[model samples]
Target: MKLDALGMAQSTLVFVVLGLTLLAFMWGRFRYDLVALAALLGSVMLGLVPAEAAFNGFGHPAVITVVAVLVLSRGFERAGVVDLIADQVLKVGERLLLQLTVLVGTVVVLSGVMNNVGALALLLPVAMRLSREHNTSPSLLLMPLAFGSLLGGLTTLIGTPPNIIISSYRGDVVGENFSMFSFFPVGASVALAGLLFIVLVGWRLTPHRAGQATAEDMFDTANYLVELRVDEEAKAKGLTLQQLQDELDETIPVLAVVRDDKRSAGYAFYDALQEGDILLLEAGPDELKVLEDKVGLSVVVTPEEDDDSSTIEKQPEHKKDGNNKDDDDSPARQVDTEGLQLVEAVVRTDSMMVNRSVRQLRLHHQFGLHLVAVARDGARLKQRLRDIRFQGGDVLLFQGGENEISESLATLGCLPLAKRELNLGQPRKLFFSMAIFALAIIAMLLDILPTAVALSTAALVSLLVGVLPLREAYQAIDGPVIVLLGTMIPVGQALETSGGAALIADTLLHFGSKWPIVMTLTGLFILSMVLSNVVNNAAAAVLMAPIAASLAEGFDASLDPFLMVVAVSASCAFLTPIGHQSNTLVLGPGGYRFGDFWKLGLPLSMVVMVVAIPMILWVWPL
Candidate 1:
């Protein structure tokens, strides 16, 4: 195919636009969506993408496919499908390795059938709960789960972004769509090998951290510590020390005792009595209030050197002054008069706060929220308080006095980043959610309608039926990702229209001429994997699918094997969470170190390459 001047110009423009987008992603100079939109506008100005075709990707079958998958995945979550599967799989707890085998295997199986990210999302909380109950770090279960999710995506056409892109490209190339299980054999083989490696060797690679140190110990909160003096009217003034256990109101922990300026050791019990005795506690606002209210005591949060500590010690002498005036002047009383509550939240992988310190974000200054401590994986972090950068899945122990920090959370653009303290099966707006999603998937799969139409219908039904409130359902769909997909789809179509794919195909074939078709196929698979890791999987797949199709045409080889290679490889995002949204989602909560992904993922990637190559050759024939 000879390139026309227009085709050459458009191709050059595509590279420029892509370069800008990548620069923006790496530089953190603008929102990703803004970058994508700017690229789209630039493409139009350069005449690379036709004005009419610019918005077509928004309605493209591929875009619809992802949206439908996300909604359907949510529906399955509401139905307890994941929990049900986990319950059966997690029961093999006696042998730790065997349990991991079951857990990884089950997730892989589920990922094959559903959207892999949704599958992981559904299973992650369950894994965390199991870890907590079993006294194990969530780190052990999460890496395997992430790997399994990636593996599972290889088994189905709609399971991951790459598969759907490859399938659509094949339809345009060979006049046929791939069957749902077209990539199953190749995907399954790799999944099996990956599962074996994870169960046997992967977990041993993680860093070891001791279990469950109190927040005070972890953050060295002694700097924030102070003494509280019990007054004659206080309820705790007459109670035994044993009455106060490890926790106050199931939140704060009581640390130690101080009396007459002297500190006592050894845990005190309910039989100990005191007046003018001092107590040391580890807590933020909410728990502190509960301690004051439940025990009929007052809080003394400031350090001993502060006025409250000195004045409380001299309170007997202060009785000579009017008591009401003294009470009104107390700092503790003033603090209580101001409503404040502390909240514990996590930084989600999708959040913008990744790799930024709280001090940089000016969390307290701008958000009216103070960061107390950050927990990652199972380890309580001890970093320079002002210098510690927040990553996705970093559990933030923060102080938020009311307002729910709603505006701050939005401005930060991070996921709640914290797992809600709710039971897995606790009922909350589930019935309606399940029905809407089920109807959408069934409608599309049965060919009763186009997928986008069916999903749009369901989105409306969900809203009307009150299965999903308007605000929440809208928020569920990530607009930035949607816009990126929508804008890129048109550019991909232009590449097809302009014969740019043929040029890429010719260039690759010149180098690959001596290679067997299967060898060439492997080369394409490896290229897709490399591109997927460096760029967003969806964007890489969209660009590479056309080129893969063009190469198959150039060789007069069957398109299925070539497409299968792309499908399997594109979904195999194993090196980093940034490669895929699902990986990012689990990063902070799973407490995964950046390097931890490749510990299990590298072996898995190798397995996929080895297994997928042969399976593609055998299953579809080159």
Candidate 2:
């Protein structure tokens, strides 16, 4: 491709726009979709990209395939695939090495057939339980699991967004996309090598993280749990458990009811409260005061909370300032403590609670649940309950009815870190999920349908057959991710069509061509891997694939090996938490600091690069 004066000017403009787009991505201040859109609009305005093609990327095969894969990943979850497989992991016993192997291996296999992040989401809590059970730091297991998901993504087309995007670019190049299992030969080899290193050696390289010393520290019940006596004139006297929450502008969970000297809580939310009914509440001193004055409830002091070390010991003395001393002097209340379940759950990347405060969740009003304590990065949050904003991977301690806890966690988009707490899934849906997935693979293998068409049709069949509800299917589609892909595709084309990629290729070859071809390939892999650590992997692939193709031409080498190198290396985002969602998902729960990933990830990256270059050359044959 030749460039005249105007075309050269346009190439410079594309370079400027892409530089700024990359900065914005690494800055982490703005959402990626917004950044990608800005880049596309800039390219069009600068005459680097045609204005007519601005919206065409939305209808691209890559965008559709990403959407369909997301929905299908959710369908598999709703069908108990993870639950069924997770039950098997618990049987791995307490041997740390054996546990790590099975844990990383399970996520690896699951990642090959489903979205890598989705597969990680299903297994993360299981990994947490293993950490808790073995009495080891979550840091040991989490980072490897995150890295394993990235490795597993290399094994299949739909495993990660980057693979799908790479395949689309390949389709545009040769008029045919890579086959469904084309990645398996190279990807599986790299994955198995990476998985073994993580299980056997890399896990020991993780930073020492010390927090949440025991499971008891997970639930904050010392001062928060209390007994409230309802009077005849109380606002809660006539209302059912849920109704009381509905009426209050500021509500606290009524943990249980004490009636006629005995406690009864079954159907508590549906039953109406009566006079003299004592309600067990999870509230702070401020909320307790609000209930005492506004709801006409009285606090009953129990014999030193449930624990001797409880900070609630001084609560009775603090409230002894006078008028209500008679109630304080009454015999210590015998509170019934049955059927209440306190469970720990992690906030997921897709959770609605992300960036939302406890006051905003309205969990009690909606799900009859109480937020007892929250731990992030392996330590309990010290901020006020309402001031605490949630982030992905934050561990939360919730107190609710035994049966209601499971439903509430699913509704709140949090995964319980407890054992065998997978969603209540039907066996029939499990069959449906697996069967539909197999059929999609068959369709692609036989070339009866294209990868995008086959997977989209399978996703549609899952919805029609009720593998997942219609509402959930819609929720499964990540709008921001889809938008980022659709908008960035055209901007990426502007980089190629505008001669910007040719300019970059010339600069790269000028300095890099003195080395052997293997050295050049190694540099490309290293550059792509480093770029992936700083930005979204899909975006890295989007920006690099064109430059990669251009570089292959400059070297007079076949494009398959170069493309394969880009595909595999772009998913090697092991050096940082922000590199991928799977890494981000393990951030808070693993108690890792910003600088922590490189400890394990640096060696792991070198391993992947060493193993991957030879594998790619041998398999794809440059």
Candidate 3:
């Protein structure tokens, strides 16, 4: 095959862009999304990819399917499906191996139908809790759970983005796409083997880090000392301090009591409760919120109230003042606290709020956030929370809408602490979420609709029915992953159009002609696995699918084995945190360093290759 000058130039440009992308991805200096976008722009500028088609990847079916799957995952999470399952699983005893089997296996199964990252997210808190209860390091459970989620994606077409991309490429080449369960035989075989390995041996290889710390300790909530006032309508008004403590489940301790400005220090257990009495309490933000809701107590306003209101209590009246001035006939819009959350954030040295007080920042008036508590190390804050100046290391607990809280935290340069599972545990819309997801899966398996359309429709229905709020639904979709996919798709096409993929395949066949076909398949699998670890799996699949097809055609063999190899290998990105989103998701929570993944991942990857090669050959017959 003679290469034309234009073809050679295009191929060279494509390879150059791909090489730089790989370097950028490995360097970790820039985010993957930025790297991909720069590569796409480079391709367009070099005339390797058309400018008009540069952004077409964002609208691709694979991208759409991923987005839909994310939205659906959020729906399942918000509906408390994982909590419902955790309750049942927690009853099965605390045996480490058995717990590992069940928790890892559940995430694997869940990954077959939903996004793997979402599956990991749902089970992560459960795994942490189990770790605490069983007195085990989370490192033993987290890596296994992350690997299980990746392996589970191998079983179904929509289980992971790479599978969907490979299936779509197959449709373009062979005129018929693989079915939803087309990957089941080989995928399930590999996933089950990997799961067993993790259950039996892989976790044993994990590094033992400090993983038994409770969420409170992880967030450093020991210094939070807040005061609440007993309201006239409060149930605690008539109860003694000890009775109030007992009613609160004894989780929080009442430190002191101030009645009519006379302070009674040290465990006011025998003090009688009275209206307008201030109770100094030692509790975290979550406990404080729960106490307020249960007893109808209000946060005590600080004595040094500046001209500006400095407490949550005064904000409503302050807003009402505006309403009264604007129109006496107009009713004020009440703040919606239905889905409000209590989040802990620590002010960074570079934070905009580093030297500002809550009163100076006007957090509540400007951002709908009310400062509930603030904790500073080495010294107890005795003044009003709003008047307390926030230093670099100050941890502040803010209460507001979940979305607003997240945005405010970012805007103020504060890092959120460990996320708390604050679900009502009722699974309010569990049946609705499950039914919709089931219908979508059934429709895909039955070929009633395209995979993208079915999942997208289910996502839309989930939003319309309020299974997940609109804001959360949008947040569910990972923006960087989408951009990486959208940008890389066109680049993959450019490689194929320039005959670069064919050249790579011809080189592989040239060398593999003397070897067995299984060796060739194994080579492809290993190469894809390496690429997946170094870059995004979707990008690996997109780049390798054409090469796999070309090799099959060159050798005059079946395409099934080649594509199957690509699918299995692409999902086996266990070598690095950046290789797969699931791994990255667990890195911080699992207390894993960058080098920590390979402790167990290297062995697991070998296991995948050993188990997957024969399974693919037997199932698809090269």
Give each model a TM-score: 0.72, 0.85, 0.71
Candidates ranked, most accurate by lDDT first: 2, 3, 1
Clashes of each: 11, 0, 0
lDDT of 2 by residue, 1-622 (tens): 5454466677877878988998998887666778888888877777777889898998999899999999999998888888888889978988878988998999999999889988898888788777777787778888888998999999999988888888899999979888888889889998998988988888889875764434554443433456777887888788877666556655465666778877765234466889988787666566766777677787764554453424344564333321233343332223344466767788876577887887787777677677767887767665556778788778887777777888788777787776656665888898889999999999999999998899999999999999988888887787768888888899889889888888888888998978888888888899899999987899889888998999999999988888888899899999988888889888877878778898888888898889888988898887
Alpha-carbon lDDT of model 1: 0.64
Residue 436 in candidate 1, Cα distance off native in Å: 6.4
Pick the TM-score winner: 2
Q: Please, what are the lDDT tens digits per residue for candidate 3 over residues 58-153?
A: 998888988998899878878887767666666667788998999989999889877887787667767766777777777778789989999999
The alpha-carbon lDDT assigned to residue 568 of candidate 3 equals 89
Backbone collision tally, model 3: 0
* Model 1 agreement with the true structure over 556-618: per-residue lDDT tens digits: 987777777777788778887667766766666565677877766777788778877887788
List the candidate 2 regions with Cα displacement exceeding 4 Å.
1-8, 45-47, 208-215, 222-224, 228-279, 283-299, 303-338, 366-369, 399-412, 422-432
Candidate order (TM-score)? 2, 1, 3
Cα lDDT, all candidates = 0.64, 0.80, 0.75
C-alpha lDDT of candidate 2 relative to the true structure: 0.80
